[model samples]
Target: MSEARLPTLFIPHGGGPCFFMEPPRGMPDPWKSLGDHLRGIGATIGQQPRAVLVVSGHWEESQPTVTAAAAPPLIYDYYGFPPHTYQLRYPAPGAPRLAAEIRLRLDQAGIPSTGDDIRGFDHGVFIPFLLIYPDANIPIVQLSLLASLDPAAHLAVGRALQPLRDEGVLIVGSGLSFHNLRGFFTEDPRIAADAESFDQWLTQAVTDPDPARREAALTAWAMAPGARTSHPREEHLLPLMVAAGAAGEDAGTLTYRDHIFGKAVSSYRFG
Candidate 1:
């Protein structure tokens, strides 16, 4: 018999492409714990995954789309980093076959889907993979967040992709838990406080046994203390909805948690 299906993850992708290089930079603190936390993400899976499907908050489209390349290229999507950072590479092979499987699954589930054979792995997809599957051996495909950014629609997309979990595919939502770019360093107490309040609320929401409570928490998520200030726009936060949908009644666990620039942030693993 095959092993049990692995849990899905909603991780804070961290800043830029720094996580992939020798030592991370730009944060006020050393981020030692965060680095260690990222390295340990693969161990919980118990074995190597056949393919990884990422729903990146960074890649949004007018409609839901998936990367369909057999051997997708790597994209250096960030700017203003050091000169050497541009030369970094992960070189993971893409999974065209698995991409077809994803398209088929989503189609059958009544979720309209499209694929781009030439699309490469953006930072959202590559950064996390560089840490979890550093060998770049596992096949990877990325799913774009739809333009609407509706939490419900993303959840629907997750439900459509759930069957892939049984086929040894690890589904991950790659986005930062806190992403208010302007507020990150503005010396504004409101930003920090709001981010913290929303973070606490999210933790409780995912941990709750009651579906109604979880739904309520998610719906009201924008109201949490510094919710809008931290998110400004909700693309990054939307990926969480997809992960939660894939979780399917399983309770979520706090896999990683920390603060950036004195603002609270966290990551979750849902079985």
Candidate 2:
């Protein structure tokens, strides 16, 4: 509801290029709900942003890294999709100045950072963004996750980048709440139950009124209900830490939640 400052977001970037491709023979369109949720984002925010700083689950580096290219190309990181999906274009300009500012902020905070001028926008940024900002009007710069994959480390990263929100930059963490490749294809009902169990725990943790307790719960997220079953690896869940950390005193609201590929997935917004 705050207009002067933009909120931080933790969103599901969808499975690969699922948005551009059709669903399998008998399956109902699995991407609709998430896609619609994404499409409504521009209106939800209530104004245009100077740029978007995205931390995608797909990109990881030795240190915290930012894409410093002026015009970053799309990196079709996903595979086994239609050829046209590879041909999809976002054409959003890259924000090198903002990237440099990010590096500066991280360094000021004693967080060693680097920049990659050649790296392109991976599927995590382009896929959901093709729906979120179709015209590619807003500039974007991607921040790579630390190779350590430590939850508290990412939270620190978010805190380092929080000032960008007041400077008209939208901070978004692109990753699914529930991401298990094996669970996505499995037909057993237990997976759904497991995802929901994790989802419930995640909702409670993020929405907690006490910010200190919220961060503590997120830092120790691996022990939450159905945590391991929801994410065999922790990469997909770590982005939420960054978003939550940037939130400062603001509490998070569950903006979107649904069962896709039979797993409960959700998105969060913090202002």
Candidate 3:
């Protein structure tokens, strides 16, 4: 039997450790629907990957980096959560061999990268996996975004790792479509409008049938409608670039779309 080519995913990880806990006061659990969607992701893809390479928005380095630990720990990486959340764990084992392979691929592409055995799984990786693969059984290797936040550069990094897809490695970019911290808890109606404008543009760009046009649109994403209003800082949005690059000529599909914390959020799958 031939190895199945794994699809690249861009997932929205909701606020903090709250996904594993109850909502604040009367607020509906913002992560409930999103979590449900993510839990079904493995089935949607039709097979379990040998390993998962996660590009988390939470971790950034001057250069690309991969976690090299054999048994990675959990990073709470959130603030003011309830006591139980602080103790929440997703004990997924690390894939050091896979990390080494990532380092090799990045180096071959002339994208500088390092391996860190000390790095742990940040909420960006653990939270989503805790829902999607609660057994914490799949081997995972976390990749870091570059501090430069250049869309083209991140895309190049993804392209460098494209071969991994056929080798049964699922590349997942974890981030939020609209990540303005200032408007996080606010009930202002304008927030939804701003998020929708950006989300719509992104939807069209990623799902564009023409590969050239799709790449071009993503390269100039800041020019999209309400781009700046949706992402005051573009770190959270950069992961999608990596996911798209690895997508190569594969078409993108909007897998999940919903309103979270008063903003429009979406998830995408490529090839």
Candidate 4:
């Protein structure tokens, strides 16, 4: 019997190293519940994947690229936190063979991708994975977003890699749904309304039954309510396009939702 296909995921990786540190006095622990949700992701999927393909908001390249290291390094991509955060480790093995296969698939799809044996796992990949797979046993390969940040192009890339799901690779897009850095640290009453507006629109778009309509909605996501307010630059939002593309005819489910720092954040699964 064939193995069951894996679902694609769009996960909101919380702010840097927040998962590893205690929330300062009087501050709500933004990552605590989200971290718990991530820890329970495997149960939702029903099985352990052979490997994970992560498309992180942190890594952007001129062209699509995959990490090809045999033993990938950890990248402490964030600053201004406790010193110990810089020394944290995940130590998951690298999926070089899977990376090569992904590059080949992208090339066949006319996407043209490169491989980097030296690339490391940035916080976007590690922060969530630390909670989801604390043992660090599963191999992981990281994919970089195109520097152009074109939604259509990334969607096509995801379409090209959809076959990996059938081959036991879990594809994950690691990014925050509401990613305005300046807004996250402040308390603004309008933030709730803006985040809810955008989140509601996003929930509708991703869950639309018709694939054509879903693609259309995502392609024009900038026109959605509070779209620009939720995402000053769309890099953080682009990952959803990829996850949706890979989803193909599958329907999306809102797997998790929370109010973090007074702004709404969510996660979705497609299968």
Candidate 5:
């Protein structure tokens, strides 16, 4: 454990290898703003964390699971990307001890969890991070989202992991605030409006001064304005729940906001 207490974050890991590969069909670098935002994360945190406990939208299991490999591999979960993206390396070591502690915390909280020695970091973990922590020096361990995708359960998962923050672990939720593939790719004019509508609601909920009210708002997120349109499936947005739960009484602030593929997106920081 280190001396610095790290803030919890909900970051938008851009769509599949978007950071490395060229934008499709001459689209103006869709990831520029997001990539820049990610690059600034290291400095924004003030100090390097001893380890990072990440929750990604791409991985899920019947119960909560944490990566346990001493030297975890990259999963290259995305397909049809440029070959270089597959070869991209982020040789960050695995924090096996941290993984063990995760399971212990979950168990103590009555939330069943296990560890996997085989699974690797998915695109959601390695992609945006390629910029955030370019040195690849800090250890990272991934925790799987519950297969049930129950919001409250995920918040509980975050709460269980919150104690690690005091021990110098940086808790991060890596997923998009707006994740509608159809709306993103299609030529519909309503996409931006719909995304913004939901983005505003999410910002309000995440930044709510009252911790209880914030959690309640997030628990019932699907009812928010354009919530379904912003997230047809809540997997991408669920990571925010984890970050918020870990935050405890810390109020959230919107650290980044932008439009990609004409859809509004956002990121949050909580201390």
Candidate 6:
């Protein structure tokens, strides 16, 4: 008999490579806890995946696209970090065959998509994969977020990629849950309060037993408290829409969640 299909995840990946290198000085308890939870994600999956396809918020394009590189290069996109971070490498092999399969799958699902053989794994893809699949043996590919950043469109992207689950592809959306960088260092009570409120609403919405309500909350997420504050720009949150959309009729489980940087941030998995 075949194994049970695995779930797709949308993880709030904290600041670049910091979680793995070492807890930064003066890092908040919640941020530290969030890092610990990322380590736990691998164990929770119950088994290693044959391959992974991540929809990283960091990579965006005018049209829907997927990365097909057989040997993905490292992208040191962040600045002001330790030199080792720039040298840090996950070295995971890419799955070109899988990339073509993704493009075909999307087309079959009525979603037009292009494939790239030379795309590299950006921080959003590399950092999380380094933690979740540390061995770097699993073949990986990353899909790009469309320029629209529209929740519905992202969900549609997920819907198109849903078949990958049955094929042993672990789909992940790499982004932060509470992603207001400027507000992260602020002492303002209102910012923290609003982030918590919005996170709570998001947690409830994603875990709702009713599919319609879950979809509604995601659709109207821009209205949630601190929505603009937490997101500023919505790319990070957009990946969740794709994860949720791939989840389809099921309201995906919140496999891991925590408030990082003293603000509620979250990660999720959907089957």
lDDT of 4 at 224: 96
Q: Please give, for residues 203-250, the per-residue lDDT of candidate 4 as tens digits.
A: 999889998898889989899998988998998888888898898889
What candidate 1 gets wrong by more than 4 Å, as runs, is: 20-29
Per residue, candidate 6 scores C-alpha lDDT tens digits across 1-271 of 1276778888877787776565547754445676677778888877778888888879999878888778989888888887888887798999989889888877887878898877798899888777778889999988999998888888878888877787788888899888888888888888999898888888888998887788888989999877888889999999898888888776667766665556777778776
TM-score of each candidate structure, all chains considered together: 0.93, 0.97, 0.97, 0.97, 0.97, 0.94
Instruction: Please state the error at residue 47 of candidate 3 in Å.
Output: 1.2
Model 3 ranges off by over 4 Å = 24-27
Model 4 alpha-carbon miss at residue 110, Å: 1.0
**Number of the candidate with higher lDDT, 1 or 6:** 6
* Model 4 clashing residue pairs (backbone): none
Q: Per-residue lDDT of 1-271 in model 1, one digit per residue for the tens?
A: 1267877899887778766455436534435567677789898789788888888888888777888887888888899888877786878878888878887887898887888978898888887777778898888889999898777788778778877788888899988788988877777887788888888878888888875567557756787766787798999998888888787777788888888778887999888
- Worst lDDT 10-window in candidate 4: 183-192
Global lDDT scores for all candidate models: 0.81, 0.92, 0.90, 0.91, 0.92, 0.82
Instruction: List, in order, the clash count of every candidate structure.
Output: 1, 0, 0, 0, 0, 0
Q: Cα lDDT for residue 45, model 2?
A: 93
How big is the positional error of residue 270 in model 1, measured in Å on the Cα after superposition?
0.4
Off by over 4 Å in 2: 1-3
lDDT of 5 by residue, 1-271 (tens): 6676789999999988888877668568988999999999999988889899999999999999999999999998887877888889989999999999999999999998889998889989988788999888999999999889899999999999888998989999999999988888876877778898999999999999999999999999999988898888999999999999999999999999998888889999998
Question: Compared with the true structure, what per-residue lDDT tens digits does model 2 show for residues 1-271?
Answer: 2258899999999989988778789978999999999999989997899999999999999999999999999998887877888789999999999999999999998999999999999999999999999999899999999899999999999998888888999999999999999998898898889899999999999999898999999999999889999999988888899999899988899999988977889999998
